[model samples]
Target: MHRRASPGSQDHFDLFPYIAILMSLLGALLTATLGMASLSLGPGVAETWDMAARDGTASKAPVLVEWDGSALTVHEGAQRRRVPWLDDQAAAAGGMRPRSAAMQRLLAEFGQRSATGYVLFAVRPSGFATLPRLTDDFRAAHIDIGYEPVGQERGVQLLSAGEHP
Candidate 1:
């Protein structure tokens, strides 16, 4: 009988095929992971809202305001002003709370632009508790408004018709 090679004597374990298979699998996995990653990044980082009316009709641009639970930050073009809220006892004393000077200014501005613009509220979750009161105040002042809730940690980007990124 032909002498067989002694076990573990001069027998080279060829790892090339196994290494090639592993590399191929790794490459495929990496490609799949990258493809999935790209699909997950929808739009930009911030949430965007169209500046147009909800009905998708041509309408006036609104004055943007951010409402957290306790205060309002009115945005007029590039300028911003914070309007403070009344204390709980003061706000709950009567059926309606009194408006601050800043709040009145916003109302007056919206009032004047009622035909061309409306107040757009970017409300945070915290603001939901007192949102009814805020809306009531706007109604009392006869200011037209549209509101949309925003995520607490997300920034908002308002895109106008001619301006979209």
Candidate 2:
């Protein structure tokens, strides 16, 4: 009978060992090409540079509010007060409900009669899903809330820092 080869006679290869090295090489090439392309393109526009309405919104600052998942806070000129933005904490929590007394009072302070009314919400990325609830709650009270719908970075920075919107 012919002698059979042992179980360890053949070597096994693991593709995973080379994956990182291959990826690193490809990524370096791609990154270098992108860098050269951007440099050739010159400085077009900065990511944070906004040249839209400068002083048109200076008449009055938009009403700003910050939501932190479980709590809501209103921003005045320089003061920030927590308000009860939810009618119930558990049942239908994110559902649109009547404003609480504290929230009503807070709104009453910034309440205005502009042709276009709005309430700015400085919300975290995590709170983005609940934004509809916040807007619905405000609109339910007859206050038109206008949001940028994009560039949430600036809003997050200003509103989260308690700055006047």
Taking all chains together, each candidate's TM-score versus the true structure is: 0.64, 0.45
Report the number of the highest-TM-score candidate. 1
Off by over 4 Å in 1: 1-44, 53-57, 87-97
Location of the lowest summed lDDT over 10 successive residues in candidate 1: 86-95
lDDT of each: 0.79, 0.60
lDDT of 1 by residue, 1-165 (tens): 899988778867899999999999999999999999888865455677777655777667777788997888877656778887654455677645566666777677778888877788999999999999899888887878889999877666667666665
Task: For residues 68-131, write the lDDT of model 2, one tens digit per residue.
Answer: 5545666664677788765674347666666566767755654554344456666656567877
User: Local error of candidate 2 at 20, Å?
Assistant: 22
